[model samples]
Target: MTIAEGCILVACLLPIACAWIAKSKGFGKPRRDGGFDNHSPRQWLASLQGWQARANAAQLNSFETLPIFIAGVLVAEHQQASQPLLDALAMAFVAARAGYIGAYLADWANTRSILWTLGLACCIAMFFIG
Candidate 1:
């Protein structure tokens, strides 16, 4: 894989790391029935409805965006895209995702959305530019 692809892979893995951290911190638990107990903050966040769902919304939103971005990078590379620009966008996407995760965990609503939007925009730009 190219550097840009590696960067996207890192971005993709961050939330899994966050989920692991959440699980380790008792935010979610593994049930004896060979399934996860979706009962902690993670589940609460995931099941968020109405006005209480923003953080979970943001988390899911980021999850949704990263893959498309990675796919775009892959397509671009296969089609002989501009490597420098793709690399830059990949790095920016990762940075924005990290910011989004941090801000969401901190419950900083405006900042989290801003970061999420930035990442999304980066991905969108890649789709077009790549």
Candidate 2:
């Protein structure tokens, strides 16, 4: 797999990391009854408050980007785009996403939006890279 592909795999797990940040780093305590209190994941997430809430929100947003990113990568691959270009764009997307996660957790609204744009641009750019 290309480095881009590897990063894509890593991106899949980012939400898990976000959850960890919220539940452990932010709360410093496990949830009652364990494992998000057996609530529907989204419902449980909606119940979060403070930095944990932000982290949960970011985690949701992280999942939101996946379909577009995956489609872009697959389309680029089908069109025989340059591997190095795909790699670069994919990595940029991942980097932007990481920044977005940080910005969301830190309540950096402007920064998070900027990073979202950057990541979206990377996904869009992939389509034209053929």
Candidate 3:
């Protein structure tokens, strides 16, 4: 598969991984008070959202990388793209995503948002440039 495809795969898997981790940690299970149910789909979604401050950043980072990946593929297909550049951007995207997740989990709102924007710009740039 192409690097772009691989990056997309990673983007899809990251959220699943986070959800599974949350479930394993008892984030989605029903509460004993009978007022809150954990096993419900809503509960799971809510749990995910509860982690949103962090999860949102991670999601942004993942999606932000998509455009650059797409752009790289398009350029490569046209024989005008540098493999090294694509590799570097891909690596940066992944690293930024990891940092985004960490910052989000830590509730570092400002920094996380800044990083998220950077990644988003990458994707937006690719969409127009490609």
lDDT at residue 97 of model 3 (Cα atoms)? 65
Q: Which 10 consecutive residues of model 2 have the lowest summed lDDT?
A: 25-34
Quality of model 1 by C-alpha lDDT: 0.70
> Each candidate's TM vs. the true structure?
0.72, 0.87, 0.62
Clash count per candidate = 0, 0, 2
Off by over 4 Å in 2: 25-36, 39-42
lDDT of every model, 2 decimals = 0.70, 0.87, 0.56
Q: What are the per-residue Cα lDDT tens digits for candidate 3 across 38-97? A: 447455445444564345445545554555556655665466455555545555655566
Put down candidate 1 lDDT per residue, 1-130, tens digits, no spaces.
7679899779778767665544443333345432335654555446444333544554466677767887878777777778898888888888988888778777788998898788888777776664
Q: Clash pairs of candidate 1?
A: none
Looking at candidate 2, what is the lDDT of residue 54?
Answer: 93
Error of 2 at 84 (Å): 0.6
Best-to-worst ranking by TM-score: 2, 1, 3
Best by TM-score: 2
Clashes of 3: 2
* Candidate number of the best lDDT: 2
The lowest-lDDT stretch of 10 consecutive residues in candidate 1 is 25-34
lDDT of 3: 0.56
> Given candidate 1, what's the lDDT at residue 32?
43
